[model samples]
Target: MNITFFIKEFHLRHPVIKEIKSALIKRGVNLDFVVLKETILDLQSLGHLKFASNSDLVVFKTTKYFAEHLAILMEDEGLRVINGSKSIRLNRDKILNNITLRKSGIKTPKTITFHSSEIKKISQKMFPMVIKPVVGGRARDVKLVSNKSELEKNEKNDDIVIGQKYIENDGLDRKLYVVDDKVFGIFKPSVLTPSDNSNAFKEFKVEEDLKEIALKCGEITNSKIYGVDVVLGEDGPYVIETNDFPGFRGIKNAGKIIADFLYFKKNEKR
Candidate 1:
């Protein structure tokens, strides 16, 4: 099998990438490493390099702006794209993710999206909410505002953020990873909580219920390979967000699972 792997320099250091690359090669798969952003050239230019045409599939991992559109272009050219461009575009917007998930009967946190101009629409019920940029990853710029003062303090002029009712958990959360028919997850501490309960991750098992929710998330996002972050609330697990390219840092055998699926299982007839 031949696959075109899209990765940028910013993500070049992730250990999982190295592991996946090595594992895929061992399985008799050929990989063409391409920097999606660097491949652009004018048709009028003397030297115009073409995207690899012999690739069986394009396995993209970067969240770089405009990269998804490029992937879409390749898909339009008859190349199979893993975790399709539509899924990546949906993952880029948290507001869209929340709305679509809810409409699909998948439970997510009560959320609202607003910009600085629409700040007056924020209600008292939304107080003590968690706020984050509509497009971001790794929890960067995420904040929990328990009061009006905090909300105002964190608010920036013309800023747009997705505010969701903070689901209270005892620092227990799950990151569910999906690769084709393989769905598994990890229980870990919430990054938003005040406590460092990372040590308790080992105690959490991959429950059947969690797998069901994770698979539902994949269906909702139309992504065969993705991640769903679930916050275990008093009622049950409420999906926090879904990732187009989830970093499976400590999850057991994640690299092998993803690599093997792309190399072989995805094309297998059920």
Candidate 2:
């Protein structure tokens, strides 16, 4: 069977991807990769790409606009894409992801999304909130603001942002990685805290409630392989974010699990 990975060039060197690639190669599966940065998507001629046309399964790894558009086009041609374009688009927008989770009765922190121009109009009561880009990953530019001055000073007045009420938790973040029906938890230092060993990740037991929430997020977003960030708040656990095609850095044997899932999925009847 043929399998194609649509990813950024940097992802080719990721340990997890490397391991998965090695395993797939050992199994003698035909594999191809399209580096998004180097490839051009010709909208006028959709199905002409040899990689997409010959693949039995396409792993939609990158969330870039071009990759998403191509994935949508591939789906239009009846090719199966993991985590689908809709799921990637939904997870890309922090505001939309929060709204969708809340509408689905999922417990999430109180969030307010507004344009940067309206920053001064925000209420002071919302101080001590976490301000982050509406569409971002890896917690880049995420900040904790205690007042309007800090909020205005920390965030640029040119893009959309979301101010989420900070949920007090022990300085550890519960990162739950979901692979199909299975879920694995990893404990790591919170992004707000300064940790010399930020890369340190340890395995943790996945509680039933957390597992349920993780699975529900998958169902809500229509994602099979994803990650859910949760923090233990005063009222149990609250989901912080859901990431599509997350890097499963902490899970043991993650490459094998993911490869097995892909092989089974590729061979299964649609």
Give me the candidate number with maximum TM-score.
2
TM-score of 2: 0.94
Residue 204 local lDDT, model 1: 46
The TM-score between candidate 1 and the true structure equals 0.90
What RMSD value applies to candidate 2? 1.9
Off by over 4 Å in 1: 37-49, 198-203, 265-270
Q: What's the distance in Å from true for residue 229, model 1?
A: 0.6
lDDT of 2: 0.86
Residues 21-122, candidate 1: write the lDDT tens digits.
Answer: 889989888888876557454545312124656778877786565666766777777777777787887788888888888998888888988776666668
Per-residue lDDT of model 2, residues 88-141, tens digit only: 887888888999999999999889988767888887877789888888998998
Pairs that collide, model 2: none
- Local lDDT at 56 for model 2: 87
How many clashes does the backbone of model 1 have? 0
TM-score of each: 0.90, 0.94
